[model samples]
Target: MRARYGCVCFAVPKKLIQHLADRSGDEGHKQMLQAQITQSAAMRGTRASKTVAGVATNAGAKPLQRSVFDAAGQTFLPGKLLRDEDDPAGRDKDANEAYDNLGIALQFFSSVMGRNSVDNKGMRVDASVHYGFHFANAMWTGEQMVVGDGDGRAVKNLSGSLGILAHEFCHGVSQHLVPGGLGVVQVAGMPPALKGEAGALNESFSDVFASMIKQWHAGQDVKAADWLLGEDIFTPREGRAVRSLKEPGNTKLTWREDDQIRDYRQYKATDDAHRGSGIPNYAFYTAAAELEGKSWETLGQVWLKGFDQLRARSTFLDAAHATLNVAATLHGKGSGTHNAVKAGWKKVNVLA
Candidate 1:
């Protein structure tokens, strides 16, 4: 079958990696990081016109089927199968983390959202861990998920980061949720890419849902939640998390090189998807924090359902409106959740 879309959703932003590479004093380490960026681009191009296997939502399959594989320090995807959903946890720490985290995400989405796996129709979730040599990224490549063992010093074991895993998984969800792929743009001679405001929505939705999953799994409310993405993936020396919904551009809460912007006023058409997502990330945070309860409840559902109606070329304002409509529909027009949703967009200056 043709690719559902060619856009690859990566956990680590290219800009951040570039920043790290640029600042690295060791030429060898810098070259290693730069090579990753090159390989990632090549991977995207490889998948530009074709889909990878292992993402079919067959009928009568397990309600939530999953499998884990070991990339064994290679770029090959979904490499040697290490464990299946029915198998016991393997000794490989990265493989086990991938399997367990995927299960957690499946449970949350299934039990709470009533969605069956990534495709919402029992599509199997396949993951590959330990991808590449010191590769500091994770991604959903249209068909399956791939994770890398980050350089031990700066970016560490991405598979161990539940937020990172969940964030990438949500990319699959978005690919399946939004018809034609969320914010996917196809130029005459370019691979289908996620760009502009729609691209930001894609990244923001990943971050928002990842945050919701993190909070829900920890049994924490919005107030109690750390609201950090990829907290476990980074060392204290490099940074805390990848991004913070609590504060988009606040490097102290996230990392030193985070270029995310919370206000729409700061957005540019050329901003990377991760950086541009900050506006909506803060919008979701604003609404959820005000709701003062578990994020996956009404607010989270409203946000998810709102994105459900979006197309490939949606904008931040488009997303804000969709979520607002969902909130008003699920909760009464003037309900607290509805007001919160409205206020979230207005606060981000998207609605205003």
Candidate 2:
């Protein structure tokens, strides 16, 4: 059997697709856009089934290896190696953005968390930009990151957004660090009963780290940070973000109807990973707010340590326990850090 890993996508949601479809002036154009979205969705599903090939694993002592490829609006993997680590920035804005953001993400893992690279062993980071014509999505394909330039009407080029790039890259990190690779469905060894919860954790970890990296890059403290994911990519009128950690269910800023849930009691077992991730995302935000410092300082370390300790089939309750234990270990048994972790989980009903 082939070793399988999760594919993380930053795709425009179905709701937004519907909204865009409604707003499209030409009926034929609307149908075409909808069809394109459908095709992208189908492509994602297919990619999920494919096994990881050619991508190197964490190995040896090497500096950061960054590569940016230009797909030039074609649906192919690693189209042309446009830039490597030795090359200076060129004219393509999308490629430049992808390369620079990859560096930022790589730096965060290396400097803040003391991780060598995405896999903690210097795995090369590679990205492909301008994938497909108005592809309307971006994804980490278990091997490399593929970014799309969205349909000009509804969405913008995804590679231009740092948050989205970081989010996808973090998925690569989670796949390497976590057991069973954080897939949406239960991988071979994961407990069947915990599949949904595992999926939620997969997304929650990505969003949490993504926010942390963005904050770190912006030099924002926990209190000052917006705690939003994909804010740059989404138009303000369309929505503020893909998800908001600070205010989980409040959409006043974003106008997104399906707001995130703050408490575990609000969790829907049937909800997809992105929707279900709100619970843990809010829990992280609450913990960061309670700690009241740079998010990457204490809360980030705790979460990173917790990710290392997470079980293959870990659920929200498991995460709460792991993070709380990590906090105590790192910040003293009954210190404020430990208390903050406990309180944050309690707010989300993960703990009493």
Report the number of the highest-lDDT candidate.
Answer: 1
> How accurate locally, in lDDT, is each candidate?
0.84, 0.77
lDDT of candidate 2 over 169-275, digit per residue (tens): 88888877876666446335532211467778888888899899999999999988998877777655566667788887577654457556777887877776777
Q: Write down the lDDT that model 2 would get.
A: 0.77
Candidate 2 Cα outliers beyond 4 Å, as residue runs: 1-3, 6-8, 23-25, 48-61, 186-195
How badly does each model clash, as a count of residue pairs?
1, 0
Q: What is the TM-score of each candidate against the true structure?
A: 0.95, 0.90
Across 117-201, the per-residue lDDT of candidate 1 in tens digits comes to: 8888787788888888998999888878888899766888888888999998999898888888877877666666788898899
Error of 1 at 347 (Å): 0.5
Give the C-alpha miss distance for residue 175 in model 1, angstroms.
Answer: 0.5
**RMSD (CA, angstroms), candidate 1:** 2.2
Q: Model 1 lDDT vs. the true structure?
A: 0.84
